[model samples]
Target: MLLIEKPTRPLKLFSLSSNKEIAEKIAQAAGLPLGKVSSRQFSDGEIMINIEESVRGADIFIIQSTNFPVNDHLWELLIMVDACKRASAHTVNVVIPYFGYARQDRIAASREPITAKLVANMLVKAGVDRVVTLDLHTVQVQGFFDIPVDNLFTIPLFAKRYVEAGLVGSDVVVVSPKNSGIKRARSLAEYLDAPIAIIDYSQDDAQREEGYIIGDVAGKKAILIDDILNTGKTFAEAAKIVEREGATEIYAVASHGHLTKGTAEILNAAPIKEIIVTDSVKTDQALPEKLKYISASDLIGEAIVRIHNREALSPLFSYQPDENKDDA
Candidate 1:
């Protein structure tokens, strides 16, 4: 007998104080209003959350990105989850656009802890039934959770942007900062029918040793893609070499715009022409004005719909959005 899927019920979208803008965008795409919630902090920095609207028997999606002030945002999310559970919500799905502390997934060195696994356990303890996140540094992080996880990609968004820029095919090189990212870089190169390039270097070494470029990019447009853009050192060094090797234009794209200290200065001084990134993590006052910011809010909103509908989410992976156009 064929299994039957249940029809999706209307969703109650709750925007935690973490990323209200992104939450509102998700709700608008889902044809729902942002759920009413009262959030505040006490003198000693304890967070309290009160759901103003009824959530009994309602499907709930709490949108929060544990980005800057990571601990505070996480506490708010936990409190919101507890609040929804107390109100007897049918299901509570935590939409963490940028899963924080994901980098510490494993201890490659001795005497270190795997904090990513700890985070998964913490979320379960906080009452999250499901998780939706984007472009994790390593996809294996999903296995840390026993609960279902939906991992979304911003590849299609980047592809679309480049296609419109008239750089999809021929005379273009899609570059990955390291060998680990070769798969992601190659996927985009195949989509654009362009060549792929890899920059091989160790972060610990400072002699500026010979870093090989995998594919030919001489006099071609080179696009460097990665998941995060913190510090921007890797891209800066790679951009300099590629430009000197005759890459006419250098562009950097990433899913998470961490934009940590010196990211702006590094990218600005590098041979790079444009630094493109999505709004997965909330932008603080540190976001530089020189970089180009693209919004993937609509794509994320669409994924939420398909996930709620219990449809296959693989189709949304590594898609390239049209270049030079804002996705409405």
Candidate 2:
């Protein structure tokens, strides 16, 4: 009998147009170079992606965040994945740092489609074997895809950041911008050994209640936490509410900073001293001085390496209030 040992598949990392800066950082952190690929848009607004190198039998990882100009970026990723599939790649894994259309997870009004599910279906149909995303707007969105979906958290990253800054004490308070964000706030609060507060201006189907801050923030330093910072209205309003409640200082923290039109003006004009966000969504727009970005490359890079090695990813998901927090 003849024995032929098949060589192990090679890992190939690629980056699309969106968030390539962080992709480079991820590649550097992973000790891998990004594979060559080119993208262009036709005069008619059609997108074309050309994989410069062969991907035959190679495990491919593509990093893309569908952020501003959402449709264009989404189309680019879908096209790239399809091209990889056609090129006989061994496997195609997608890392979407900022999942677009995730906020449309459900129908709030009549005749509205669940666009988040629709996006999931589209990606799965585009031949993705697995998906890695950061801090999904709704965890339930994972169920929308049949393929394995890993939703990584930014709380641990934020926890480490604040802890190192010596902001982990009783005088610190985690304030949720909305009622729905209380859980996110509470988690960070627990990590920091701080109390949690909620600024709720929820308008029920019947009545509209004015915004109020729950829990004590008087003379406390506030960290307003939210998943995404878009339009900046939520954070701006929440900061004002917290300020009115006698919070001495306010800092805004978010997983992804979309920072759409007028967001800088809004956030800068707010009473916030600074804003901390991850490099999940790369933006070229001139950022404000208050905006400080902590890199997520290390975390996502470690994740990619572990997944490539078929190692368990739970360690990356778990965090505690220990003095030494593990850096991903």
**Candidate number with greatest lDDT:** 2
The per-candidate count of clashes, in order, stands at 11, 0
TM-score per model over all chains: 0.91, 0.93
Best model number under TM-score: 2
lDDT (0 to 1) per candidate: 0.81, 0.88
lDDT of 1 by residue, 136-220 (tens): 8789999999999988877877787788789977789999988889989987888789989888854446655667777788989
In model 2, which runs have C-alpha deviations exceeding 4 angstroms?
Answer: 1-7, 202-209, 319-328
Residue 244 of candidate 2: its Cα lDDT?
92
Model 2: how far residue 273 lies from native, Å: 1.3
Per-residue lDDT tens digits for candidate 2, residues 136-254, read 99899999999999998989888888888888788999999888888899989988999999886767777965689879999999999999988889988889889999999999999
Where is the poorest 10-residue window by lDDT in model 2?
Answer: 319-328
Residue-level lDDT for 268 in candidate 2: 85
